[model samples]
Target chain A: MSVELIILIVVITALIFDFTNGFHDAANAMATCVATGAFKPKMAVLLAAIMNLIGAFLSTNVAKTISGGIVDDQLITPQTVFAALVGAILWNLLTWLFGLPSSSSHAIFGALIGAVLVQAGLIGIHFSTVASKILLPALVAPVVAGVASYLGTKIAYKGKHNLPKESKKRYRNAQRVSSLLVALSHGTSDGQKTMGIITLVLVAGTLQLGGDQMPWWGQAPGTGPHWWVILSAGIAIALGTYSGGWRIMRTMGKGMAEIEPPQGFAAETAGMSCILASSHLGFGLSTTHIVSGAIMGTGLARTPEEVRWNTAKRMLIAWGLTLPAAALVGGLAAWVAHFGSWGFLVVLAVLVIGSVTIKIVSSKNHVSHENVNDSHEVTVLAKAAISSVTETIPNPLAPALPEEIADHPLAASPLRLTGLKPRPKPKVPKKKKTPPKSKKKKQRKAAQQKAAVAKAQEHEAAREKAAKAKAAKEKAAATRAAKAAKAKEVNDA
Target chain B: MPSLIYAIDWMALLLVAAVSIAATVIIAALMSVSNYFFHPPKGEEKASQPRRILGFIFLGLMACVVAFGLYLMIPYFH
Candidate 1:
């Protein structure tokens, strides 16, 4: 492929990566708000999208260092960037499929390192930058944000066991405001990364074409990405945000903590503050890590048990794996794509196939705006339904009963209890096309049905007998009272 | 380990922690105080006009804080 064509492909790939980044991190800003019912799932994502778009337009400072100083700028090639994006995009899809909130930025850094390692060996990588920037911040950001959230939550619940209705509404309003800020901050920080990548590719392509001077648009690197670059990146991220990663939202919002309005307000404010402050201080922290930490802190503030440690552990594992996993993928893609245009095409094919497979697999147990609030595990309502159904109608036909649900009865027939249509008595089937296992199961079911019928008849007989005896005793009492009255009247005469 | 520590800007980390904590605590406290004024104990009579106004004042302060946050996010102002 021509240099311009390759550059164009890389630009498109970077935009695709930016889109994935948008959806993957949407949970960070809006999860708590959605969990607390401050915003409906659809409305929450929509508001977050708008805020991210606005936030993207608000700043360009972060776009200067494309890899955040992780890889050697001198060695980065358009082809390597393409491989890196493929790795990042695939990793993001993989994490999103499992509903884990992994860091999209770290994925990019890892991919860049991996691709560069293959392209130029160890010399192209900066080990110290990785250690100091990505690793340290990943470890520290969460803890700091968590502590702030904990203290804020404590203050929120101070001097009150149960907040009044009016107070909850007030907290809800505050939570909404905090959540919007988080979204805006997310947009500002993440929206520019794509712009930087695009700009980097453009500059590299122009130089490779033997241009002695910089393009009019790219004359000053510090001036940031071209106006169109910013616009396109902003739109791409916003659209991705609007798409809504309901799976990850469910995991973060409900899986981690049972967030109330007060806790939501606290966690969001804590996260937003940390993000804004850290970014301003020139050492950008992972927004995902900070928000996740804040959420856990709020959970702890309520009670230790309120925080789902198992879910937290799972998330921690995902965060730890994000870098290495993306790096591995990036390395493999780079190795394959190093062969030339055909090799790049092959890598692209694999990425597409992998993404489609993940998307298909995720659809099996769908989580959408309608069911986003439902916990991954069987929800309380579903559990209640199971109990009521099992208690009154513990028949074999009640679809696939678990072993834990035991039979219960309250003077009611299973038919009335379950509201299931009564099956016709199994007439001995003649010449039916039946599988052998199903036929045997059917025979067993028939036997059980006969026994249940017999039990019902016995119960009916006993009830009738008791009712007759009660009628006879009442008759005898009335006759005795009448005779006593007659005897008293005769004695008076 | 020492080099990693040296590489990190400790002042920035400290600033982040302090700013985040201070902002969180202040915002949460303001919201709580406003809620308290608007909704006192169950047995108490309805809050007087001045108390309600005080509650609004707290909420207004919260709005101001939010505005400051907006300003911080926008690099144009910075």
Candidate 2:
């Protein structure tokens, strides 16, 4: 394919990846708020969407970091970037489907590294930069956020406690404000990643076109993303946030732990702080990791029993596997796309087929706004296990009762309740119809109605004026009477 | 081990950790404190004037922190 065509494809794929990034991390901003009933699920996502859009425009430091900081852009091609995005996008979809909150940033980083390694080997990869800027920050950010959140949660509950009703009301309101801040910071940080990737593609494409210099908006060669690139990425992420990732939201909000309002407030505030700081420093750390860690920390602080260690273990496994898994897929994609036009077509076809298959399978157990907060399979399994153990202990008195053997309460009832009692239908009030009037008659009736309204206004104003006059006269008479009484009392004395 | 440690930007990493932890804690604490002060026990009357003023101060501090964060995002700062 022509270079121009390839650049176009890469840009579109980058936007697609940005969309997935927004929806995938929507849970990070909204999960706790939704779980704690601070905001309705739909409203929370809408607020997040608007905030993400505004946040995208706040700064481009992170974008510059991504485009130039991690990899040697001179050696990599736009096609390589495209392959990396495919890997990242597919992984994002896979994790979202499983209700796993893995890092989209890590997936993209892994894919880029793998693709670059396949194309130009170790020379194209910046190990030191990756180690310092990306990897180290990733390891530390979550712990920092977690510890901070733990302390915050501890302090929040330290005071002489208010009534449950009052405290809950206060915490819920506080959660609303804190969650908005998280969503705004998320927009500023996560939305910039796609902008960086798109800028990388543009830089590569410009170089291929024999342009030795970067665009004026960029600080230096490959230093900044173009304005249009920022706008497109911001819009894509905002749209994705608006769409809502109910499945992952359910996982983070309700699946990980039972989040109270105060804990939710603490977690979101801490997560927002870490993310905003990282973005300012241009570190592309995962907001998912930070927020999830904070949630877990707050859960531990509030009540250790509330945190689901098993679910957390599952999430950690997913996080551990994301890098290598995405790397392998990215390498394969790069190898396939190396063959030119036909290979590109094949890769595209595979991506479409794989995405369709995942969508079709996910439809079997769809998670949407209506059921985003419903207890998921893990909780259901636990409940079932508890009930089964309870059922096994046979009651000695009811050992021979066949009805008692039934699991359902209604089934065990001796009086058969066939169905719910039907209610009486409400009587509809009928409208009376009048005979059709001629045009002149209608006009006269309208005029008469206006006259009647004017007359009523006049009468009302007159009545109000009379009432005010009467009240003033009564007040004067009362004051005079009081003065006369005082004078008479003085004379009598 | 020294060489390996030297190869990494240990200073920057430490700075990041310290800054992140401090900022997160400050923000969370301010928010939680604001919540506590704003909502007193049910039997009691609503927040007194001074307590209300204190709550607003805490909330204002939190907003300042967020604003400062956004200010840091400007490319010129970096």
Candidate 3:
């Protein structure tokens, strides 16, 4: 009964891990497409979700192995698997909080290795598989994809000056297609991992207790995941993809490199092809690593300076730490669960508490689809500065600026936002002059005065013309009167 | 060292790399050629009818390759 309870926990945790896997890798497919404006942010995620749903039902071959036989499943119980999942989920959330695209597959593998170490000691792990399968592919796959994308981007830009609007539009359309393939490839690879884990847990539980008696839910070690498992895993992952990992999307799309439509098309094509080929060859390469490398390669092909090496370095560090960090946490979880059922409850408590804390911290620095396309580091820093400023210094002049500008994320300084402030009055003899205005106001006043002066001059000119005409008319009338008087006197004589 | 070497299938890895790079390069080249003829640079004569048809043919080929990639993903196809 205790073992069954553990198995239930393991299955639930596996599904949760699958959910994280979906969102964590959502950027791998849609980031380039969204960055290039081929699809709107919400629309891109929706398309990726639909493709992921279709791809999950495509195959169950990858579900056959958990860690490719790295951890000896017979030695470890479902409790160990539960601990491993806890570690992987925490790591996934941690990396997501930092907006780093690390591998969910590697995280699980690392956690399994850690849990195995705690349960069955060093003898339970296959070190060679770890090196060749995990480490080797991690190193090599990215390089291959990078080189391919570099070449592809070059080909895309050939005869490039003033690329026609029609051609650019076509490239965006091509980017959408290639991005869909990537999303499908991600679904086929990642969605199957949780199914694999859940199946392993069921098999391990049934075989350990029942021995030769085959249970309804449990199949042989080499058998496919059950239909219910497939449906649940597919739905969980599709829902997660629809949730849209905006933080990681922003990091991949705008942080590492700025992607143009043609470059995005090339990167998605190259990355998708690499992932498909590797998966076909039974190599478990990370979609995140391959796509990130392809984007960097494409950026370098066009303008090397645009690639943010700092962010890339940070991502590389996170990738390096993913396995070991997950291992540490998983090992700790296994250690706690080894104490008893109480320890298991304690582990569950830690997982929930840790997840909640990370969520709270992430909410404090929220990155939604609206601000996802903004330059990441600058926007984050600016937002941080503004929030701090707003807390510390109450901007007395905030009302003076436009309401929208004052409340903008990038508007850190009120002075900078409005660029208008009352100028300090210059000291002049009190009787000599009125108060000095701001430079802008002075310029406006000068313009107004110039218009007034021009109006006054026109008025004076019109008055002089009227007065001259009146004087000329009066002289004519007098002359007529004198002429009449002279004529009358001549007539009387 | 020997164990590590045995654990990896180097030939398969190299094959995957080669195939992916080749496919990407070919697709990119085909798309470029299609664009070059279909939507030529401004201040130049429009591509002739035969050239436009040739561009369409290249585009059709690219579409076929993408479809082939999709076909590879389907497990039943294997």
Candidate 4:
């Protein structure tokens, strides 16, 4: 396919990845609010969505960092970026399916690194920039947020001792505000990653078309993402946030830690502060890591026992594996996509099929707004399979078959499908007949009564209006008389 | 150990940690202080004049800090 067509496909893929990032990390902004019941799941998601969109307009520093910092733009093509996005999106979907709060930022970084490695070899990847800008910040930002949250939680509790009931109410209100900040900060940081990717694509496309000289539309090689890029990224994330990632929200809000109102406030505040600072510094820090660490820190401060160590460990494992796992997928995708148009077609087909399959599997035990806080383990493929099997089996000791099942055609088949019995329809209750003349009389009476009530209401409104007008006129006359008397007294004096 | 340490940008890392930690702690402290002063214990009279004044001061400071941070996030500001 043509480079323009390929660029279009890459941009669309980048937006898809942005959408996944929004929904996946939504829990970072909203989990505590949902957990503390400060806001309903739907309301929390909506608030985060709005804040994220606003946040996207706040800064392009992080986007500039991603577009021009991590990988050498000169070496990689739009196709390479497309392959990286595929890796990141698939990783995000996989992590979401398992309800693990892995970093979408890391996934994107890893995918880009891997794809670039495959395309232009080791020199195309910038080790120093990656180490300083991405890796170091990822490691330290979370720790700082965690410690701050832990101490913050302790301080919050100390304050709570003075005002138990009132503090709880205050904390809940404060938590809502803090979560909003976190959502906005998330928009500033995470939303820009997609903007950066899209900008890089445009930059790379323009560079390819015009040899060494910079194109007119491109302007200053790497100042920041364009306005349209930022807008699209913002909208994609907002739409994703509105969708609500209940599965991961459940994991973060309740699974890793049993959060209270005060802890939620502290955690969200710390996460928001860290994210804002990092974004301003142009560090593409993971909002997931910062929020997760804060949640764990709060859990430890409140009651170490309350923190689910196993769940925490599992999440840590996911975090550790995210880079390499996404890298592997990205590398493989890059290799496949290197084979021209036919390869792109094959990869697209696989992506569609894979996404549909994951969707189907997720639907078997869906987590949605209604039951997000039920605190049950998500239905895994194995568990779903077992449940399906159990549902099919009939108790052998049962007295007799139901009449409906016995009479069904499939029941007589050699397969003896126990669970395939046709459902029996409910019998409608017979209606009692009424005399037509009485019904007509009642209807007319009801209409006449309605008209009388309307007329009475209008009469009452007119009377009230007249009373208000009379009071106004009386007050105006009294004021006028008082003013004349005052003027006459002044003249006499 | 020195070589490994040299490989990383210690100054940048320290700055990130210090700023993040300080910001987080300050915000949390502000929240704690607000809770203590604004929401007094049950059966007690609402916050006294002095305490209420202090509480408002803390809240105003916190709001300013957050607003500044957000202001810095805008592309134009950078």
If the candidates were sorted by their TM-score against the true structure, best first, what order would they fall in? 3, 1, 4, 2
Best by DockQ: 3
Which of 1 and 3 is the better model by TM-score? 3
Best by lDDT: 3
TM-score of each: 0.79, 0.75, 0.83, 0.76
Q: What lDDT tens digits, residue by residue, belong to model 4 across residues A276-307?
A: 66655545467899899999988888888778
lDDT by residue for model 3 (A371-459), tens: 67855552332344232233344466555657766664444454453564423335676675546668769889899999999999999
Q: Quote the lDDT for A223 in model 1.
A: 52
Shift in Å, residue A49, candidate 2: 0.8
Q: What would the TM-score be for candidate 1 when compared with the true structure?
A: 0.79
* Cα lDDT listed for each candidate: 0.84, 0.77, 0.85, 0.80
Residue A400, candidate 4: how far off, in angstroms?
11
Candidate 4: TM-score, chain B only: 0.78
Residue B22: error of model 3 in Å?
Answer: 1.0
The recovered share of true contacts, given per candidate in order, is 0.80, 0.55, 0.82, 0.62
Cα RMSD for candidate 2?
A: 19.6
Across A358-394, the per-residue lDDT of candidate 2 in tens digits comes to 7776765667777787664322212222211212333
lDDT of 1 at B76: 88
Q: Which window of ten consecutive residues has the lowest lDDT sum in model 3 chain A?
A: A378-387
Q: Score chain A of model 3 by TM-score against the reference chain A.
A: 0.81
